[model samples]
Target chain A: MKKNHSGVRIGEVTLKWFIALHLSLIVNSLAGVASKMAGKQKFLSFRFCICYGMVLVITFAFALAWQQVLKHMSLTFAFTNKPITIIWGLIWGVLVFHEHVTWKMILGSAVILLGIMVGVSGDSGSDGSSLPPEGGKGDV
Target chain B: MFEGLGRYIAVWIVSVFISSIAQVMLKMEANREHASKLKEYMNPMVVSAYFIFFLSTFLTMYALKYVPLTYSPIIEPMSYIFVPVIGVLLLKEKISRRRLIGMGIMIAGIVIFSM
Candidate 1:
């Protein structure tokens, strides 16, 4: 019974982390979308101010959530996950910007997705082992 | 300052570097335990990091105005490369072999996608 309970707890924790990580990614991508939208307006115009202001607010949210993610994951893994935004950007481009995706782009995105899976799977360590002690010299 | 391709590359790299610094600073901020107060948001490191990031963003926008179609592909992924290296040197983040390979594959994928 104890073993079964522990396994359930682990599953719960994994699910919680999965939700948190993806939330961060989506929010980060939204910030990019906001910034891109802001770029379309004239600088210092009221519309520009509104769009850019939204960007700032959304970016603050992204930063906060990203910090939270780093608390649970290693810097290396988190940093590597930065490329995931590219996939989001492509999706946004197609849906929002009406951009076309060529075959090369699709193949490349698939490779990137594969890479993210490999990277995330390589680490079972909960506490980012690659993250060094604060202000401590890293052995590299 | 954005006339030539070389200058554009320089500006793009500088912007990426600044962005990487911001990334590291945010990571450092994350590792700390702070109270939920206005003062916490006013932390000097966090503020400066944001300031630098804003500057980087502005420079990128400006640089793009001059060379948007030509260099956008390569320049965008430069940060993915920069952050990990900066994270290692300045932030003392270690990289395992598997993670390194993963990063390489991701980067190659991005380069291809951008192309």
Candidate 2:
């Protein structure tokens, strides 16, 4: 049972680290915005390149941050928070895309989020570290 | 504003399928033995898997041109469903009851949300 200098346990992290991880998750979600913008541009156009390039940069950054976050936080915690991205997606759609929000969409998103939470918890419960990184999922 | 919406949905589904295959490829790579730790990550399989992911992302972006950003995330979990089913068939993996229930819930949610 080796403890880090921060007195954190193997799976425990400080609140600051937790917030940092969420920020990274939000950053990852922002790539979806860029993706949508890229989709609107002509393929291989300057604006398209810029938007897709931004997506790549954000993905790389999120991947790096995810590794760092995993070191400080347990996979269980990280996986649990992953579904929060769905909420973020909804928020971005409404605020950025100006898509109308219907009660049905909200309810459906809630159910999907709950299912992922259940499914991931079951998989990680047996062996947390054995699974591959799930960064690609829910990414635009 | 929604012309040829069916084709756009098809493109999104194809992207989801590609991404799911990439996920399975990653799992396959994880289950393999490499010469060294570095080789484990930098090998052909891992590299190709990521390349496939890139293709998927491009398709997703293309689909976004026609599909709503909000709707894309709703159906995005289709890949998650595909992975487990593919795993069960190709990898001979077992599905736990809890996992089954979760999948059911997700399907229900997708139905409700998109309906």
Candidate 3:
């Protein structure tokens, strides 16, 4: 892969990129669901371990997918789309966890959706590089 | 001082901000070149980033004991606000007008979501 003068490669937006982003979000949200399930068990108990194990696995997938996302999109674009995970959370809550949602929560989610749409508007073929010109490198 | 929804928001904010920092670290780790591709994983910064990310995930789960799944999503946007600020301050990445606008809108959405 060839990097530009800025040492960052430009991304070409494609259907595969979109699909990967959504898949990442879905897997990321599942980590939350798994965590919630783990909360019901005693810490480090058999049940807790199983639930937490699921969290770890799902999170591993999320991290891997997120790296792919950053390769193809800017952090701003990638983070902006993260709110979609809320919808997935709500779905899991309603369908799997049987959690209740109030009307206000629905309204707030709608506004968040609007904001996500506006945030991503006209972002295609734009400055999607992940690194700056003068980069910082060190271990923390 | 924080309790109920306020506490959940606070925890979520911390988690997302830390996660964004980890994101930047991973991106930096990605930029470096190594003879052995697997050696990249051994970079201290990358390892630190993943460790920080693990802590963030733990905090998220801890907060879930108090927060419902539906409400937790509202806090996810906090990273959108945080990542750009850190990008500018730490990474010195340039921000475009459109991105600024998008971030502004996202902030507005967060405010409304918090209500």
* lDDT ranking from best candidate downward: 2, 3, 1
Q: How far out, in Å, is residue B55 in model 2?
A: 0.4
Question: What docking grade does candidate 2 earn?
Answer: medium
lDDT (tens digit, per residue) of candidate 2 on A19-125: 88889989988888898999999899999999999989888888899888888766877877776777888889889999888899999999988887787677664
**Model 2 over residues B1-115: C-alpha lDDT tens digits?**
4359778878888888877777778888888888899998898888988988889889889888878778755767676578778777777877778778888998899888988
TM-score of chain B taken alone, every candidate: 0.77, 0.89, 0.87
Top-scoring candidate (lDDT): 2
All candidates: CA RMSD (Å)? 6.8, 3.9, 7.7
- What is the per-residue lDDT of model 1 for residues B7-97, given as tens digits with 9 covering 90 to 100? 8667766876777777677677867888777656689887887787778765654454344322333445555456667888876877767
Q: What is the TM-score of model 1 when looking only at chain B?
A: 0.77
Q: Ranking under TM-score, best-scoring first? A: 2, 3, 1
User: Going through the candidates in order, what fraction of the true interface contacts does each contain?
Assistant: 0.27, 0.58, 0.34
Chain A TM-score of candidate 2 vs. true chain A: 0.83
Q: Largest DockQ belongs to which candidate? A: 2
TM-score of candidate 2 on Cα atoms, chains taken together: 0.88
lDDT of 3 by residue, B46-108 (tens): 789878877876777777776777766567655555666788788787666766776676566
Q: What's the DockQ for every one of the candidates?
A: 0.26, 0.58, 0.28
Evaluating just chain A, the predictions reach TM-scores of: 0.68, 0.83, 0.70
